[model samples]
Target chain A: MPEIIRFGDRGILVNFEQKIEAEINEQVIRLSEDLLHQHGDSLLYTIPAYCSLTIQYDPKRTNFKALSGSITSLLNRTTSPATSSHRKIEVPVCYDTTFGLDMVEVCANKGINSATLITEHTKPTYRVYMLGFLPGFVYMGKLSQSLWCTRRRDPRLLVPPQSVAIAGAQTGIYPSEAPGGWNIIGRTPLPLIQPDAEEPFLFKAGDLVNFKAISLQEYHEIEEQVKTGIYNLKVSYGF
Target chain B: MASSHLALYFAKPGLFTTIQDKGRFGFQAFGVPTSGALDQAAADLANQLVGNGLDQPLLEVTLMGPKIQFQGNGMIAITGADLSATLNGDRLAVNQGIEVADGDILQFGRPVSGCRAYLSVRGKWIIPTWLSSRSAITQNGKHLTPASIVQKGTTIRIDTSLVDPLRSSSAAIHPPETDPGIRVLPGPEFDRFSRFSIGEFFSRLYRISPDSNRMGYRLQERLSSFSPEEELISSGIIPGTIQITSSGQPIILLADAQTTGGYYRIANVVSQDLDILAQLKPGDTLRFSLTSFEEFS
Candidate 1:
């Protein structure tokens, strides 16, 4: 049974596990999607994380005891054994020295050359485990163990938008210029988040991402097209 | 047009000042945080005094206050911390609504108590609402990031025509001088820390760190450390979540905090006491007290 804990005055947290695991997050996503589909009206918002789902609601609409009752019932229901997405979209990256702010440090720390880092980083198709920290910022993970190292002791005060970064076992793209401590390896020209658009977020949790490297010249071409709103990134059917 | 009737030009943008409302909701699933006024009560009180709905957009001033020049006439109210506000060189009451004429300059003195202040004028604040909120939020709610803090010489328009000041009796809300114990519920990872860490958490008084801002308050003290675990998952975090970092220091997340986090959340401040947390200034000391979950209702 998922542990039901009080999040605050009007929210309940359903934790599926104590540690991070892909399977656990899959369960969390399923539960969140199921509950939202079943009782979204009663919910003010639902935030799904690696191993937990936090449901926030209005006290007037439904108190903790009442909300917990519904959540408990949903928890009793068995989560289907599977993944949320089979499709993987290709993401183009420019790993030039100018774009990769600390490519040397990451290469040295991980004991790999730039070629090996780029090849290994792009070799495996990563999962969109969750989106957090900022709008359109998707956290994907399980970078090869050899690539695993802690985040910077002192985070940069400013990391530009769409900068591809890795920290420890995870990787993410900055949707916007924000403070972060991740090891920057490359940058993408695509706008990963757009608040005013009909669909503000580009990558949803549970999706898969494939990285493709491009030259700096190609990066400029794509960037120019993006500026003119005339470019579209390649996304094909997956898994 | 009503928007033209109210224009604000800042002679001095003291500290951090920006527009805020109840915040954008229903966007957390997309990693967008609800960025609203840190002191909701103060924001509401200021709006109410000006005859505007409590959720309407208003100005939230942090630490220091802004110096504003009005282009037209309107009713206005200032609430929250006693910033010693003035209108056209005359002292303005903290919670009372007053009328202003064109060319009037609204200014503030140093803060007397509390950490934030709210200013509300009659009519809607005319600005683009990104994702249904105007709270210029992001980056720990510190006025440091350019996300929403108003810069000097910027003129902001508001839909306006002065309403007679609400004239209804407005209560002066001076915060209590007594140090408040922030009420909290045990976090999901409450027991994950050593028992000594938990005990130390309750017994110790932590001063707010200088780096603190709207994102979360970084506490000055360290506690018995929690061991590092590999593969910690990134997960949902909310305002009032007291997360302990690897450095053993605790950070109390507030409005504009990251949508999700990976640190161990040791406790959560109750909803009622969030306003108290919002009013905290750097160097101020605080301690936590556990409360029953039932108290949430």
Candidate 2:
């Protein structure tokens, strides 16, 4: 049984095993979806992390004892993973020197060329674990051991929006300009967040992402098309 | 138009002024930070004094306050910190509703007690909202990276003609707490640290570091040499979580804190005491007092 602890006065934290395995996150996400569906009226929000799910509820509406009891019952009923729609998204990345700020340093450290870096970086169909640190920033992971690299020694004060960066086993695209310590290897022209849209974020947790390398010319072309709202991202749903 | 009758013409925008309300909820799953007023009580009081709803968007001024000229007549109130506010060369009191005439210039001086002050004008504001919130994500709430800072010469419009008149009398002035110790409950990883480290965390004095901001308050004092036993998987965190870093210093996450973190969460400040911490400025000294969930509620 997962441990359920009180987080502050208004939050309840449901913790799984302290590991980064995909199966644990799957359980966390499943619990989050079930909790939302079952107790949406009482919950203000829920944050699903790698191994835990934190639910913030209204203290005025329901106290901790009642809420935790309901959560425990829900967890007990949950025996199998809930089957839901998942998406396979192919994101286009430009690995040109102009946009990839620390590409050369990363290549030199790994003793590999830019071509090899691109091939290895784009090889995996990464899973979206969780989104945090910034709005719409999707944390995807499980890069090949050969492509794993440490973060930058000196973090950048402001990484440009849509910069695809890697640190340790994790890779993420910055939805907006933010201070980041990750090593930038490529840039994506697609806007990751549109606040006014029906769905603001490009990728939700539990989705699968694949990167496709494109030339700088194609990047600019796609950028312009995106600006005109004519470009369509390669996406397959119901995975 | 009603906009012309109710507006604030800003001649000087003080340090770190932003529009804040109760905050944007149900969006943490999307990695959005809750970028609202740091002090909820003060924000609500300001709105109440101005005859606005409790969740109405109001201006939050940090340290120094703004110099606003009323374009037209409207009821306004200033609460939270007493920044020596003035109206056309006359001293203005906080936590009270006051009427302003056209061309009346309101200015603020040095802070008297607290770090932040809230200002609310009588009416429904005409500000644009992103993701169902009028709160401006200026500093740590940079999820959208919108340059939402209230700059000098900016004008804010309100529909004062539509709202009802103020009915309540002036609110009583509630001063900041004199106590230096913040009450906290043990977190998920409270037992992860050594007994000595845990004792040091509760007993030692910690000053708020200069680098502290809305995201989190970085404490200056470090506990006697200790590091996390193992790397923690990134997990959900709330506003008052106290995460101990590799260097042994503790950081209390605040209003604009990220939804998830990988550091060791030793404790979480109770929700009621969060307002006390919000009024604190940089260089303020504080200690932690362990409390039980039964006592906290």
Candidate 3:
């Protein structure tokens, strides 16, 4: 069972076990879908995090007491889980030194060679826990324990867009240039966010991701195709 | 359907000005910030004076107000901050509706008390809507508006065919005076903070740092005692969330704050007091007053 607590006066937070686990995040995502479909009219917005869902509601429409009660009853009466659509997205990444700014540092810190590092990094079928911190910036987790590394003491002022990076127990790609402390291990040529497109985000919560290692030549070719809007990301639905 | 005509021209854009509605809603899950008017009450009052809906898009002028030339005659109301505004060299008062003629230049001088002001013109704003809002935002290299910030020489269009002539004669109401202290409710992580840290948070006078922007306000002083043993995961946060940084500084997230952050949310400013913080300029000093949920309700 999760705890429904007051977040200020206008918001309510449904908090589960505080941790970064797939099962915990799955519940958050499910509840988010339920609220959007069921009680969205009363809600201003809902933010699904790793193990929590913060719901902002209009005080004029609904109050915390009534909304929390509704959420509690909804949680109690859940029949299986809200089966929403999910996707498994395959992203092509190049680990060439030109793009992987911190590859050597990561390899040295983990006491492994570049080849071993790439294999370990690409081995996991990471779950998309949530998208926050940046627009379309997918936060995935449970990287190979061997590759678990701390973020840099001094973060870079700007990490280039589509740079796949790892820090602590999580791995994600920077959708745009931002100040980040994660260790950059590869670069993906695909644009993860399209603000003006019909579907703005490339990845959403509850999606699965797999990283495929590519050569520098392939990276450039795909980059050109992406520039011309000819390349499409390989995606598998209903995972 | 009437075509919108150019209404206001920005001869010299202010320090920082942008279009804001109630907010960009239904997109926080995608990490989109709800960029809107920082001072909701002021924005609402300004719009009400012009007989416009509270959610109508308007300009939020910061620190210094803009030098605007009226391209078309319309009823306008200036509220929130007393920036010593004048129309064609004649002084104009806040919270009052003023009718303007074409080519009338409105200029703002030094800010008297507040950091931001609201400018509401009578009409439907002819602005691009992103995520179902006219609020302008520039995040992660992408802009919601054509230009990131309102630039000089820009023209704003509005449809004024439905303008209510009686709205310009609406009596002005006194805007609420901002309190010196901000009221706040304990956040989810408030219990984790040490007693001394909590005490200092409510007792000490903190000044708004110079680097404050639409995203959040950074305090000049750090809490004397604050060191948490655990790192908080990145979680959902909204405007008015007061997060304590690793360095013991408390940052008050504002209208354009990111949806999620990893810092400990020590407290959240009460919704009623959010307008007070919005009107406070950089270098302004204030203390926090702890208020319970029951008290706020």
Candidate 4:
């Protein structure tokens, strides 16, 4: 059972566990979905973190006491483990010299050649833990231990859009041009976030992602097609 | 149907200017920051003075102030910061509804007091909203208004049809000139700090750093250092949550703070007192007063 603590007069924080774990994250998402199901009108929204869920409510419509009671009851009812029905997304990356800014530094730090570094980086199917900091900037984690490296001592003033970067045990693609500290390893041309779309961002939490190495030419071709809103990347559960 | 819009052209957009309403809600799960008026009380007062609903979008001016030309006639109210303002060469009154004549140039001079100001018109501005908010310059994938900074060529469309009966009467408030000690409550990781560190936090006067922006206000002084044995996992964060960085300096997250953070949050600023922090410019000195939950609860 999670410990429900008062976040503010209008919010509540449900702490599932103190530490970060995949199971905890899964439970957080599951409980969030359940709460959304149970009290759709009462809650303004719920923020599901790695090990906890924070919910904000309408002060006039619902208070902490009533909302927490419903949440606790919902948690008690849902005993089964999370099904983890997350979709698989395949993203293509071009680690060419022109696009990969920190390739040399990252490869040197990992004590591996460019090809070996690329191979190891693409092998794992990364999970989308949560999207924060920037829109469509997926914070995925558990990068190969050998591939881990310290973050930039001095962050770049501007990192271009679709710049796939890594730092420490995590990796993600910058959805837009912004200042960032992560080490850029490659670039993906896909527009992970479309501001005009009803659902701006492409992926949600628990989505599994696999990066495929593509040629620079292919990256540009996909970029052109994506700009026209006609390109759709291949996503399959079995793959 | 009546168009009910008043368009204004910006000639000078001061240091920073953005459109803000009450706040953007129900999108924190996707990591969207709750972009809103930095000083909610001022914005609300500005809206009320103009006889508009509290949730109406208003211009939030920071530091210096914007120079604008009203394209249509409407009642306008200026509140919060006393940005020395003049409408068509006539000294503008703060916190009072003044009718703007078409083609009248409204310009703000050097800030007389306060760091931010609110400009509320009687009707609505026809700006597009993202994630159910009109607030600007956030990381939440919201498209920046063409002016974004209320640039020279940008024209903001507003509703001028609604006549606020209280248009002639002026409402004014004298914001305190002296530094009012900020009130704060213990944060989630408040227990992790040593008793001495806590004492040091409240005892020392802190200055707002130059690097501060909409995302957060970084304080200049470093607190007593005590590195935690364990890393704080990335968790939910709200505006006014003061998180200490690795260097032991405090950063008070503000209107545009990210929805989640991975730092040890030592305290959170109460909503009522947040305006005091908002009015503080860089190099301004402020001290914290340990406020109990009972006062706020």
Candidate 5:
């Protein structure tokens, strides 16, 4: 079940029945699209989380009761499709010692070999569940049970942009320079957030992500291509 | 730098003064926080006094206002804090427009009440607008740093062409008295806490700590009352959301707070009563009462 909760005078939070359900995440994304289709101008922004969607608006222009009632009605009237037809995006990652700062730490904690951990992490398909904390940072989840580990007790004061990290059951990419507590496992050359780009963010909620391991040399080549605006990774979308 | 326009020189710069407007909206998606005046009542009052639009730019002075001298004839008004004000050595009344001739000085005394004050002029301030807002955010010092307190030699421009004589008049408006009851509504994460913790939250009176600011207000809650092991997933947080951290201290998110947080939110302060919270100074006692939107609307 989808629940609508008031955040403040100008915001409403749509939460799912379960905290980490894939169906609920899809519903949130679909609802976000529906809201944008219906009242995009009225909305200040939509924050899609793991199992919830928070829609912020201008209170002077939008009435909370009417919007919440309308959303509830919409959710009740519609049934979410069994599976979301989303795009599959492949991200090239370099798991070298320098880029993967916590690779040794993760291996020691999981009691697994570096090669085995990398193979398992890259093999599974991950879903983008939320975008938060920073611009263009995607929060995707439910890593292989073996790769799950606790986050650092104290977050790094500054984690460089494009750092791929994992903490517990989730994985994410840093879009900008920000403080982070996640264990960095690899680095990607792609720009998750580009303020000057025509499309600022490459990935949205409900997108499928596949990690392709690349050599250090390939990483440098891609980095140079990205800087020169020549690198173009395949990105296809259906729904 | 010399300009063709007139300038107002500062005689004595008081505590803190910054330019403000209605605030920049629709930019949070770019990770830009909306920065504006802390007290809208004071800002609106000053704007109304000067016959400017309710959303026009104004000076937000903290506690005490800046003492300024006019370079040319201009209409201005003082609102917000009851900081006794004088124009050209003559005491001027609050909420009223006054004309200051060239070389005339305006001084502000210590505040009688209220933490913030507003001053407005008939013509808009000639400062550059960033992200469509003239309001300055201290965090964005690199992009738009706030002007320092108006000093004895500092000068500001006045657009005589935009002045409206019809808007010049002084009206008396008193600030509201401090209220003790702070109303609140149950939050989305309210059920996550133990029943005893919720009871303690409602019954206990929390004092506004000295470490309060535009970002948040840290309150001293009884730590032993609640023991939460669940690490809350970071979620969208808004102004007035009372988030209790791992150490069991309650921090109320405010205007310039981050968009998302990973702490448990016990309750949300009702919108209508947020102004009351904003007016509270350090050492003030606040009692939380559970309520809903229906109580205000």
Candidate 6:
């Protein structure tokens, strides 16, 4: 079941059944699409989290009570579909010492070899659960349970942009230069945010991602390709 | 045909003054903060005086305003603070528009009343807009350097065609009292606080500390109780988040606040009362009153 709650005067939160199941995520995505199609102007933005979709709107232009009622009624009437025809994006990553600052530390804590860790990480296909904390930063999930670990107690002052990290069943990429506590194991050459580009962000919520490992030489090559706008990222649809 | 410009030279940028507007909305999901004028009342009043729309851009001068010289005949209004303003060595009136010709220098001295002031010209000032707002976010460390004051030799370009001195007028709305009774609504985590702490929060006369800025206002108060948990999973925090730190003192978040925070939010100040809280300076004492949205409306 989906629930709608009040968040201050100008925002409303549409929460899905509190579970990490794929069906719930698909429902959340469908709700996001429905909200966009129904009331585009009333909403400022919709943030889709793991099990919740927070909608922010301008109070001056929107009536909160009416909007909340509409959302609740909409969710109640809509049934969950079995399949999610969402897009899948393949993200190329370099899991080397130069960009992966916490790789050695993570390896020491997990008692796993660098090669073995990299192989395990890239082997599985991941689902995009949410986009939050920073712009273009995605929270992907269902990591191999064995690889699950908690975040660093003391957050690093600066985590370089595009750094891929993992902590407590969650894996994400740093959209910009920011302070973070996640254990960094790899880095992506693609710019998560290209302000001047036609489509600024490389990924979106409900998108599937597969991190393909590349060598240090390939990393430099891809970085140059990204800089020169010569690289093309493959995106396929999943039913 | 007539064209005019204003020149303001900075002798000293009193605190942090910058160009501000209503704020940039619809960008927070993209990791962009909606930064704008700290005091909306002042910005709105400035816009009203100049016949600009309520959401139009205005200069948010903090504590003191820039020393400006008129280049042509125009009308301007100063609101927000009683900054001992003088026009060409003569005292100028606050809250009302005044006409100034070429060579007239407008000087704003020390603040005798409020912490920030708004200065508006008859014509809209031409400033570049980023993300649909002219408001400066200092935390980004992007624009507006060490100089907080719009100083001498500083050219402020204006669209003279938009200037209509005849349309200038006074704001009918009176400024709210500085020592305001701040109203707050119970938050999601209001139950986290001890009973004694809740009483003290309402009973104590907390002084606005000097360590206050656009991000948040730290209140100096002695709390009897506090929660042991210092960290929480990062969640959505808005402008009015009254988060109590590990030390038990309350800090009210404001415009330039971070997108997310982990602190426990005991209460949220209503939107109507935020203007009253913004005018508070160091040494000003405020008392909290718990109220609901229905009561506030």
Winning candidate number (DockQ): 2
Is model 3 an incorrect, acceptable, medium or high docking prediction?
medium
Calculate each model's fnat, 2 decimals: 0.73, 0.77, 0.63, 0.49, 0.29, 0.18
In angstroms, the error of model 3 at A28 is 0.7
Point out the worst 10-residue segment of candidate 2 chain B by lDDT: B139-148
- lDDT per prediction? 0.81, 0.86, 0.86, 0.81, 0.75, 0.74
User: What's the ranking of the predictions by DockQ, best on top?
Assistant: 2, 3, 1, 4, 5, 6
TM-score of model 6 (CA atoms): 0.83
lDDT of 4 by residue, B143-213 (tens): 43333346656788876675445533566586755656998878778888999889999988898899998
Model 4: fnat (fraction of native contacts): 0.49
TM-score of 4: 0.94
TM-score of chain A of 3: 0.96
What would the per-residue lDDT of candidate 4 be over residues A88-140, giving only the tens digit for each residue? 99999999978899999988877899999889889999888887777567888
The RMSD of every model to the true structure, in order and in angstroms, is 2.8, 1.9, 2.2, 2.3, 5.0, 4.0
Give the alpha carbon lDDT tens digit for every residue of A97-127 in model 1.
8989989998988788999999989988888
For residues A110-140, what per-residue lDDT tens digits would candidate 2 score against the true structure?
A: 9999999999999988989999887788899
- What digit string (tens of lDDT, one per residue) describes model 5 on residues B1-297? 233355777766677667778766654533345557777777777887777887777777766678787787777888777777888778887888777677887888876776677888777567766656777664433323345224446666756566444654666666656546878888878998888888888888888788887667888655467778777666777668898888889888776666667788888887666667766666767888998756431
Which runs of model 3 end up more than 4 angstroms from their true locations?
A78-85, B1-4, B164-179
TM-score of structure candidate 5? 0.78
Q: lDDT, candidate 3, residue A39?
A: 83
State every prediction's TM-score relative to the real structure: 0.92, 0.96, 0.94, 0.94, 0.78, 0.83
- DockQ, candidate 1, comes to 0.59
Clash totals for all candidate models? 2, 0, 0, 4, 3, 6
Q: Give one digit per residue, the lDDT tens place, for model 3 in B1-297.
A: 665454788999998888888988899998888888888988988898888888799999987888999887888898888888999999897787888888999999988878889999988787767778888765652344554357889888888876554444455544435437898888989889988889889889888999898889999889878887877788899889999999999999987888898899999998888888888888888889998888643
Worst 10 residues of 1 chain B by lDDT: B139-148
- What candidate 1 gets wrong by more than 4 Å, as runs, is A78-87, A109-111, B1-4, B140-148, B161-169, B224-231
Q: Between the candidate structures 2 and 6, which one is better when assessed by DockQ?
A: 2
List pairs with backbone clashes in candidate 3.
none
lDDT of 2 at B197: 86
